[model samples]
Target chain A: MNRVCIVGVGSPSGDDQAGWLTVDALLDLGIRSGDGVVIEKLDRPGSALIPLLRSTAWLIVVDAMQGEGEAGQIQRFDETGWPHYGHGLSSHGLGVIDALMLAGELGSLPPRLDLYGIEIAGTTPGSSPGRAIRAAATRLAAMISDQLASGFSIPPGTQPGYG
Target chain B: MTESLRSVSIHVPVLARVEGEGALDLRIDNGEIAELRLRIFEPPRFFEKFLEGHLYSEIPDMVARICGICPVAYQATAAQALEKLFGVELDPWARDMRRVFYCGEWIQSHSLHIHLLAAPDFFGCSNAIELARIAPEEVRRGLRIQALGNELMDLFGARSVHPVGVRIGGFHAAPALSRIKEMRDKLRAALPEAEALVRWAARIPVPQDDQGFVSVAMRHPDGYAIEQGRIGVSDGARIEAEAFDDHFAEHHEPFSTALFCTYHKRPYLVGPLARLNLNHAQLPEAIKALLAETGLELPSRNLFHSLAARAVEILLALHEALRLLENYRPPDSPWVPVTPRAGVAIGCTEAPRGLLWHRYEMDDDGRVVSARIVPPTSQNQGRIEEDLRLSLLNFGLDQPDDALRLHCEKVIRNYDPCISCATHFLRMRVART
Candidate 1:
């Protein structure tokens, strides 16, 4: 019943910083940030995402992932349909899947959920993520901003404006 | 003894509900358990080996990666060791805030284990999903407490998982007073729920069996041990962290990927049960009174009481956090300057699981020359197997394989075994004829 939009950011350094970078881009675009929106930057949130997901009406998760697609590819995951593009479990104790599963089981998942994953080349401590991945993060942020500006619902089988 | 079944082998190729991966093998032949191995097969991440040549200031962050669940313990332990070597003293505010951060970990970790991992077995449920169908209210309460813990953690440490706030001498930065005040209010609001959780845990149908095992934990003169304390055992032995190496030794066993630790050549219990058993008298009066009011026995020998002990600790942590928050003051500087000195120093603190011991040898330029870390789960490995042997022997060996497996899982979960933390997911394979 709430009209809140939740954005979860990450704390990975190299390529995994895509999520954090996206949030930065969104802020730069001035996505209305009043009582209606809540943005959270987390360092390996793990299962802690449960409560946040439960309390909000709309959820958007930005994270760096590795999959079959070329690096810098952006994919969107819905509530019932999770992406299976080779993004395995998180290096943290519980990954995003663990949180989503727990939320579904507890009947606490928000009504509308959108997970934006940017395909990354590397996430090592010292290595830099590919330039394409950073561009994808900015593009992903614009897509989210446009969607939020309008009504934030996607028709069945239709893709968002941006990949 | 039932003569109908003379042999039993139980293999759970993969253990569910534990933090990491491992395996459990139980073999019973001729009415005797031939083998009971808590196999830890998770590949080591080689944290210690990689720590070499890293700047001394980076030790906290590097070691924090040891286990996501108990990162604070690793960070705090490493900081303490380096601080000792450099003769740096932390400001009082920073020291107390560390305890607050640790309390958050205890609350969240214990609540997660009790609700999501361990409790399902007590109700004949496979997981929290099934428990939700029956005990929805309890599950919700647990989630609320867990959320509060996360909130506290985020406020103080900047994030729940692998917090980066902690540094070598203290923290990277001190939080504003307003944030602390907000957290205090939330904690105070959740106080009743925490107490209710303790009461609820007290009522759980725990399997009964005495473990005549030695309990080891940290004891502090000021109050309940959280961040600072000396190691104390139930057998009246006390030692400082530096003396830990002299008394305790880790042995490599072919069966386990993790080393089995022993104190004075004997297995000892750590974690919540040990802390409660050894430091029952050290609890604040309010907590002690709450325990008396709840009517749970003190110094419990039954390993199953670990659940109740965890609940009590949660309540205590909430209370302690609130009290500490009442006197919130931001220090002029969060960290004290450290000058690199060449020395080997040891530090030990109680993780939510048990005692986390760290030793470090730093070079003159403040680079780590060598580092050794003994996490709580590794220390409890031998004791876990021993407890399993004794408990299984008493649970009546004639139970169905699944029943026995569940019982074994319960015993293992009682330790809240972070197989990942211990050098660990468990693939359980049991073979019986």
Candidate 2:
């Protein structure tokens, strides 16, 4: 069985919790570890993500992002499109893009890598995820669950874009 | 020089590889520096003010939030201060484990700075990604060592970033023997890699720009101080943490939110280089031998040697952690009970960056009435400015704006300045006349 790993990268700040909330939504949907799927949530893992990326064969990363789109917009990106969206979004020193770049340089990127980004409304400290973000997280969680159920392979010609 | 080129201004909107936001402004007049300001514009995060009214038990976690890169320093310093005021003496087990935990921080923080932040500057690369392209094995080894350090931190603190395992008396819980054994095996394996890193760092061909500055760090008679020691200055003065204010002062700079600190009104150096300068003799004999092999002298005068210093310290931290964890026994309790009394508390520790000092005034109920935490980066601000002035002069003022700006950044980043922790990156505006 091909091992599949789902990592939700986020902090607890407001809409930044989208990633973790999505993970929570996954658990709520009965998509869990065992059965060749590994679930993990990371709080601003930064470069620490490299080791995890190296350990898995198939990887799906869910994160909150700010982009030129409406709040709670869910977008899917593979390796090519992920890099373009990864820079300058993190207030932390090394963001997800930087980590992916490092992993790429080190040849640690998984054989199959997918990124799911939920457009965040805000990242106010000590605040909970807003209504739109929570809804988006749920939607993304179901989408990821369907992907996991289908043996972790994207269908051919499935264009990358907002869901 | 052309009349128009005599006065030039260079501005860097944001600095890369630094921990937080800041900028630099330089004005050169008639082939001389007329003005240079290491402007730190990161919003003043009133962490000290935020500590007011918080319970003493909350300090370790709260302070840890100050810097994601070196949260252990903040947590450990704050814990030490509160423990001192409360008359809490940690169990020997807790004490040893605390040192081990701190070792984790040193290893990880130093590794990150060396591999990701500082190394690229020396290699003519823009970032760690570029550095990896040139030195994939070194970068991989660095990441491995960094991961091992984070694992060590996680052993005690429960997580590497803003760890919550620390408390006033000791850690909230002791790590299991199984985990200790696992981490010990990893640390032992990384020893050779760390040594190789020292050799690689020594061969980096750092520029020969040595300047005069006072060196200050904590000195432990038992070992190279990490968690405890008396303040040691290069001028041969020893002081306790309580006397820190009397000997050193923090003054406001109009250009930066971070305070510029001075030892007796003169800028001084801190962090790895300072630690190695004052306490190299305390290092393990093997580490000393490795330093000798690298042909790096103790009390090194060149600031660029800081990279070497950090590498040496990483080796030291790895060895220290291994030695301590070799005979690990889970204590009945990782921490002892504490009673709070109203009084002023003070503690100091060697943070990965430099010496971190913490002070708190506690009420009878064990709540903080006031708090003052001094991080290493802010303390280095004056020295950074001083270094910038001397280094640029030595490099010659006839250089172009971009060259001058990059040189200024190189100098600042050499300190491993955590602008966020210091209330900091760096924008560079160089004005020349």
Candidate 1 lDDT, B1-433, residue by residue in tens: 5663589888766654345567888888888888889988777768889999989888887787777777888888888888888898889888888888888888988887888777877888876667767887888788888778767777767877778898878899988988888888899888889888888898888888887999999999898887888999999999999999789999998867788999999999999989999888977787788889878787888999998899999999998888888989899999998898988978999999999999888888988888888988889999999999999988978787777887887888789887732211245454656
lDDT of model 1, residue A82: 84
- For residues A123-159, could you state the per-residue lDDT of candidate 1 as single tens digits? 7775665698779978998998888878654335432
> Per-residue alpha-carbon lDDT of model 2 for A1-163, expressed as tens digits?
2467899999878999999999999999998888768899998787888877544777889998888888899999888887464324566567787788778877777678888888988888899889999999999999888877776553454322210
Cα miss at A66, model 2 (Å)? 1.8
lDDT of 2 at B197: 97
lDDT of 2 by residue, B89-108 (tens): 89999899889999999999
Please give fnat for model 2: 0.45
Judged by DockQ, which candidate is best? 2
Model 2 chain A — which ten-residue stretch has the worst lDDT? A154-163
Deviation in angstroms for A161 in model 1?
Answer: 30
Compare the candidates by lDDT and give the number of the best one.
2
Candidate 1, true inter-chain contacts retained: 0.17
